[model samples]
Target: MEITVHSSKSVKPDYGDSSNGDAAFASADVVPLSVFDKVNYDEYIFYVYAFHPPSPPTTVLVPALAKTLAEYREWAGRFGVDGSGNPAIVLSDAGARFIEATAATEFAGSVKLLTTGDKVLSLYPICDGAEELLLVQATRFRCGSLVLGFTMHHKVADGPGMWNFMVAWGQVTRGVAIDPVPVHDRTSLFARQRQDSPAQVKFEHRGAEFKPRAGGEIPGVSCGNVAVHADGEEVVVHRVHFTREWITELKSRASSNRGGAWSCTTLQCVAAHLWRSVTEARGLGAREATRIRVAVNGRARMKNPPVPEGYTGSVVLWAWPATTARELLRRPLRYAVELISREVARTDDAYFWSFVDFASSGAVERERLVPTADAAEVPPCTNVDVDCLLAIPFAKLDFGCGPPFFFRPGYSPAPVAGAIYVLKSFEGDGGVDAYVPLFSRTMDAFKKSCYSLTPPMADARL
Candidate 1:
């Protein structure tokens, strides 16, 4: 299909200032581009696919196309990054193509279905030299459908920031003005120096070298299978909320066993539930070893003074703990929670620096990192599996559109077996929404378990 081109914008040239007695592109001014730059800025991408009803009329798709164009124009005005220090907005040919193609493909890909996954591979330098801050791509299928793809650098924005941009795009497409443009706040969550003494390491891990026993592909269910075939029905997202009381109880339970180590109750409980659910779905007994990793932010954990909150820089960290299924099930949930909590804490200490040192020391071959069968094996897991917590408040992210139906997390290459969970706080309800991606079969097992378990016990609170 011939995709039409729309309007484009670019950041003002003067935005980046080499003047004022400062060096060009101070480390502070430029957003860190690498995941290794910091711990808090975990790299991730979000994608949303809007599938039209089967055999939809062309007339209906035209209005959708116009709306999409308008939305891109407004977004170009709001967040374009200039080459210089000052933040200026600019739209590029690449950006325009990405937006127009996505709209056009909706009618071309014969989508019948859509999906997204975490892009775990390292990012290479942009060779195109486009002013666009995001890499948007779309693929059309033989069956009149489309898959819209967006690759955003974490330093430029977080999940909340990206959602804000989406909201603006949606509103502009609908021909509405966004009220009270969102403010970028960089003062609050400044990156702290490593010297700041703390009681214990926030997060810790066991078996950093543990590799998975199985190497090749294993026959399992796909997302499409679970969404369409498992029970032979359409799959719709269900937003859920947990009472504050439940959060408190979970925190209390986790803290009780750790001798009061600082741990995020939300992270601990969610991990435990997912681990157990997957084991049961695979019909693997609790005794089988499994490995899970949580991505952590390294902003405050750095030895350097904390970076200002609005500082667009890369701040990401990853921590993994591997254990046999038998041990995970045998231990109290609190134990697992403590393990996660401790691992998070340690990132601020010398251990975190050691990791950085090792990674920078030399060019490590990918094959060496790949696990062998005889190697002390741990169940496989990837960053794509864990739900990344976008620390920014959702309410703070306003891009013109009032809000979104839901903010889903997506990736490029699918993970081994689990799904990526994207968390967003609803605008009016003050509730948390998690976009979970799982194998079609696993989702089926999850639903069945939810239905069979007693109501109160089945609650995520437990």
Candidate 2:
């Protein structure tokens, strides 16, 4: 677990576009934050990729990263405040922080365990404050295996965008052309329409997303049966793997009782399964509400001038679905799936526009509000949020030898509960992996409940 840091430095873009022969943002420019980008102003996303021997060394990887950053200019920039005092990225070629380190032990057999513990935190470069929008660490093990770690502020890009950037870096390392050039103009993709009036606000942002629902007394918000976690409770991440057959069965069961017209999607069915299981494991009161915050991407939902596939930035919102514990347990799996599907369907183009308009309305500042999606702001115990990374092209992220044998969220020492990250299985068998963070006390119950399709039977056993 010991690591020795050999060198640390800021890496600027090494080259410019071949066509134009000019570096992007050659002169410093400030890119204003869109409504979506402002959601995670203080949060960062961490990624750890384990690469075995015969991979590109730091000598080549670092330059490839610099080249990749040249194309994705925002990653090489630093955060700053715009003229309006709104969060923005200063494209001043501030350079991303890169560190080269060495680990004494071999990394072949211990990728999973090494990443699960707090020691994994050493793999990532320091990203605190406004030091760097993007930071990377290359840790070479005794056996020549490399553990590449990346940390990017969520304000700079969402999960999909960051993944795309990672893929681009891999493409650069392999000397391949970067496919699907990224579009970084946040104003065009997410800003409120220029024709619309500034005062036009469609949704009640305070009630729906930000502020508490007029609860002068109740400690929990009913949005998704949100309740406070016990103070000093230990939260641990428990991973549950679903094979293709198990997923198929879950989907079949979730789709069984529903009308012929309403078959559940993969995400809906699996999320429902997890939601029900987690709720059952918690053993909440009959009247206690439980809800799951489903993360929905706004890219495909936008209309008119549609958001490009490669558009980069945060354009994600949560779909909150709630039901009482008794009702959830009493209902069939299909019922829970229907609830999830219905709520996800509600987050259409209109909903995204409403959020964009609401962000610019000055109401957020006036009300002193923050989005519940921010993990720091989320109510710890009763809340369950799901982030799906099923579509990310993990296999395409081949630097030289092959794609990463394993990839996962970097370990955080903080106690976070009820967040499930649905990822594509490393086996590439069309299966799924759910990394569930829960109170350590309920992990055993969750492990048993997650595999049971019949909630009644599962609850009885628990």
Highest-lDDT candidate: 2
lDDT of 2 by residue, 128-203 (tens): 5547888888888898888888888888888888888988889889998887677777776655456653435665
TM-score of 1: 0.53
Instruction: State in Å the error of residue 17, model 1.
Output: 12
Error of 2 at 94 (Å): 2.0
TM-score of each: 0.53, 0.88
Enumerate residue pairs that collide in model 2.
Answer: none
Alpha-carbon deviation at 96 in model 2, angstroms: 1.0
Question: What is each predicted model's overall lDDT from 0 to 1?
Answer: 0.40, 0.75
Question: Which predicted model would earn the best TM-score?
Answer: 2
Judged by lDDT against the true structure, how good is candidate 1? 0.40
